[model samples]
Target: MQILSRPYGALHYRLDGPEGTPVVLMANSLGTDLRLWDAVLPLLPRGLRYLRYDKQGHGLSDLGQADRIADHAADAEALIEAVATGPVVMVGLSIGGLIAQHLAAGRPDLVRALVLSNTAARLGTPDSWQARIDAVEQRGMASIADAVMERWFAAPFRATPALALWRNMLARTPAAGYVAACRALAEADHRQATAALRLPAMVIAGDADGASPADLVRATADLIPGATFHLIPGAGHLPCVETPAAHAALMTPFLERHAR
Candidate 1:
């Protein structure tokens, strides 16, 4: 229930674990909120601050008029300055990953390391994203829920009852919020700036991810100088949700290495 007041509106955020410890800032994908990293939190190493928030237009947060990645990154920069004493380890998924890249490039001082999962510098092309925007604009969020589920989860996970919960989360998202995010994604291209980042970074991909395929994820990894790349087998776009244990396993050691 924590909320941070900003020019756009109130942003919903949750801060857990001890104060003064290293912070892990997690950003969710387009249609999700802070809960996107819920399953992975308890599995992570102890004695660290975990900060997650619902981006503008998602979760319980305000959906301002912002339609660019930089605007979203600016909100995050405000969060870091308000709560953190120093830089943080940013772990982002899907569009969250794009947000991380933008932050690390624009506010490198606020980010100590990065874990980019199931995302790319440039996601879908403008035309492809426009088509998606048109679909949702015309039929609403539910219209694309099934297609999104396929890209989000592998067949095995889709068969589980848990799948329905996430599907509903997608369908229930605010259309305006979702559309704003789609507009942002349609115009974002971070490759040029991300390739210039020099800090520690890790890139992860789900072998079964249809949205950001392995090859695309690998190409993003190739852009950064010395980034460690990993592939999670049998997982899809949202691996932190589908395979939290595996996701945390990769993140634990990295957190320990960079802990303040």
Candidate 2:
């Protein structure tokens, strides 16, 4: 783990593989830290550089004034610019996908390719997200950890030890930061921005994902004009956890093909 100071606060990140090799920066889903990529990390080709970081308020990253997805994207851009060089393959999931879209649209020079997984161009989150943010602000992160976890993973994942670990992480998250992230998701609108991105892109979705359905993923892929779409079976939102091998197989080629 390494700490890099940004304009808002310190950002926590892990860098792997060779420094001079092609860089891959991974942004994780909401409510999940960089640990969410643990299962898929080892599957990546070792010759390339990789960076995984906890968004503000998640994992070991600092809690900054983040109340919108743009703020998150700015922080991410700052981190990438501070650490990696030009033209990185940015891989993002869930809310991270929105951030990636924002980055690619706003700062195309830094992004060479994109992998958006289990996410949408625009998150049509119902009022439930706002309600949850209010609940967290009023009560605490613990107040909604269970409910959030239920929505994060599928039924089978909830029965595993990994679920317990995830729950613990949620419980430990600062309520203020969690609420901030919730508010960010509530205000984010990536539809227009993502539609305009012309980078080499891949959209990976889980057939069983309720959050970002397959049809939505297909629509997003269609909008990207020649973007590749891969749907993994027996997986929900977190395909890297539910079907790591399949997820890795699909991503390995895409990343390698686009690597500079």
Candidate 3:
């Protein structure tokens, strides 16, 4: 792991492959660390630069109080400027996707391409999301981690060792940090910004993803002119975890097509 100091706080990240190669910046969803990409990383073709980072208050990154998605995007920009060379292909999941949308729209020069997975342009926390946030805040992530796990993985995945590992990780997340992220999700609105993005983009969603259903994902793709949309069957919110090979297959073509 590498550490870089930014104005907001210290950022934790990992770099892989050659430095001069085209860069792909991978960002995790809310409550997840950079390790969330562990399965997908090995499937990616070598010889390309890759940057994976834990968002503020997750994993080894600083646990600061960030309430807005813009603040998160700024942090991501700081990390990109510090580590990557020129524009990058930004791949983000869930809340990470929201950050990517904000950054791609707000700072077009910094992004070469975008891949959003299991995310929506306007992921407004429904009544259930708010209730879950409140529950986590009051009783800690452990209290609701199981329920969240059920939503994240498919029925068959629940019986796998990976599921247990993921549940453990989610259960251990800091309540404060989790709640802060929830607040960010609760207040985010990327619909307008995503509609304005002209850069090469793709949207991938799990067919069984309840958080961001297929229709919503398709709607997001439609909002972005000429963006490609792919769906991974039998997977839920976390496709990288449930179906890493499919995730890589969908992403490889998009990245290769847009490679600089």
Candidate 4:
């Protein structure tokens, strides 16, 4: 129930682990909350602090007027400055990846490394995002939940009872918040900024992810100066949710070098 106030509203966040440890910040995807990375946290090594928060308009945070990734990035920057002991290993998923790009490029001092997961410099096209916005706004979050689920997970995972959890999570999102994030994705294109980055970085993609496919994600990785890319077979967009162990395995060593 920790909270941080900003001009927009209050941000809900949770920071775990003891004081003075290297911080690892986890940012959520669209239509999700801070809990998105819950399964991935414990799998990582100990001796590090974990910072996760619900973005404005998602989870328990206030829905601010700002709808741009830059605004979200600024919010993350503010949170890190107020809470983290120093630079952190930022793990950004989907739209969260865009925010991390902006934050790292603008406030390089706040980030020690990056793990851009199931995301890209730019996501769907403006027209595509506009259509998605129209659907959710007109028909509500439920209207797009099924389609989103398809892109989010593969067929096998969808059949499992666990899929109900994420499906329910999507159906419950605030339409206003979801729409705002869509607008941000429509306007975002971080290729230039991501390319200019020189920090230790990794880009991960689920082989079956329809939203940000492996090739698309690999392309984004290529833009980075030295970012390593990994393809998780049979997984979808949020591999951290679908296969946290695999996600953690790829990240642990990287974190050890940069974060610890």
Candidate 5:
């Protein structure tokens, strides 16, 4: 519940675990906040510090008219250098993963290792993302909530009560925030940059993720030499939510081995 003020806007962030422990920074997906990692927090290794933040327009963070995928990366760079102040095991989901790639590529000194979950090197086509942006602008977030939820959660999870909370999160997202993020995704192409990154990297894919399908995530992993790719069966885009324990199982070991 801390706000880090910057020239662009204020970033909402929270820190946990001990002061001197290894740091793990977790970034959230588009249209969601730092709360996206709530399920996975307790499962993380003990005695390690954690940092989670709301991207400019999402969660409790300030919103602006700016739109650029790299802006998110820049923000992350500043945050890591200012607050964490040490090499960190950076973990990100969806668009957060894209930001992680950008940060690690540009500021390798700040990142010790990376965990990219359910994200692609490049997301969707400009036309497709623009269409989504237009829809959100004209009809609001509700216009795209159902379709987004379909891709976000697996069918069985959608049938449960937990789906309601996610639906509300999507529907309640600011139109400007959602559209700006869509524009960022549309314009972003990280294949060249991410492929050049030489670090301890791991990519996790959800077997049923419609947004960034398994093959697409796998290709992202292929871009980085020696990067490992794992698939969480039956999970969708938000595997950390649909199967937090399973996601932790994959992540804890990677962080433990690399955090040293």
Candidate 6:
């Protein structure tokens, strides 16, 4: 339970692994916190430090607002500086992936490699995201939990006990935080920026992903030079939760090859 205070607000984060090793900074999906990486973290390559943080308004982080994805990227820049950690392998999911792309282009010095999981360069149009925000605003997080869960996990995973935990997490998220993220996704268009990044990158997708389908993931990967792409057979949007081992299988090698 570490908190780093920023001009906007405080961000809750956790650091793990050896102090002197290369770092891996993880950004969570919308409506989730740093814990989203729990299942996949342990299976990563040894000797690399990991930093996970909850974006403002999510988890233990302070409540705040962000209209542009760049604002979130700037917050991440401040976070890395506050931690005094060295260059990192940036790992992000969903909205986190958009932030990763923003960081890789804007603060290249802080990112040695990048992993984009279950994300797109551009999500839905502004109107679509606005509708989602209206739904949450009027009815609370519960209003969209079923639809989000259906998109987040495969049917089989949703039938298990784990589904309850994820549902609770989503439902408990701050409306301000969740809606702010929705706005960020609505306004964010990283296609031009991401297309110019030359950094080493790995893009992972789940075949069952309804939010960011495999085709969308592949298209994002296509924008990068020399980026590798992988498809997890039975997983959905949140593959780290649905198929941690499979996500790790793809991540460990990338970390081993690049994070060192």
Write down the lDDT that model 4 would get. 0.91
The true-structure Cα RMSD of candidate 2 reads: 1.5
Task: Single out the weakest 10-residue window by summed lDDT for candidate 1.
Answer: 63-72
How many clashing residue pairs appear in each of the predictions shown?
1, 0, 0, 0, 0, 0
Worst 10 residues of 3 by lDDT: 123-132
lDDT per residue (tens digit) for residues 99-147 in model 4:
9988999999999899999999989999999999999878899989999
Residue 192 CA displacement from its true place in model 3, Å: 1.0
Question: Over 4 Å off in model 3, which ranges?
Answer: none
Candidate 2 local lDDT, 1-260, one digit each (tens) = 69988776788999888777778999998778888889998997778888899999888888888888888888878877887877899999988898898899999999999999988887767486888877877888788878766656678877888788888888887777788887888888777778888889999988778678888877888878779999988788888877899999999999889976
Distance from true location, Cα of 242 in model 4, Å: 0.7
Stretches off by above 4 angstroms in model 5 are: none
Query: For residues 121-172, could you state the per-residue lDDT of candidate 5 as single tens digits?
Result: 8998999998998888888898888999999988999899999899898888
For candidate 2, the 10 contiguous residues with the lowest summed lDDT are: 145-154
lDDT of 6 by residue, 184-228 (tens): 999999999999999999999999998999999999999999999
Please provide, for model 1 over 66-90, each residue's C-alpha lDDT reduced to its tens digit, 9 standing for 90 to 100. Answer: 6898888988899999988899999
lDDT value for candidate 5?
Answer: 0.90
Candidate 4 residue pairs in clash (backbone atoms < 3 Å): none
Best-fitting candidate, scored by lDDT: 1
Full-model lDDT, candidate 1:
0.92
- So what's the TM-score on candidate 6? 0.98
For candidate 3, lDDT tens digit of each residue in 10-66? 888999988688889898987789999999988887778889988888888886777
- lDDT scores of the candidates, listed in order: 0.92, 0.84, 0.86, 0.91, 0.90, 0.91
- TM-score, each model? 0.99, 0.94, 0.96, 0.98, 0.98, 0.98
Give residue 51's error in model 2 in angstroms.
0.5
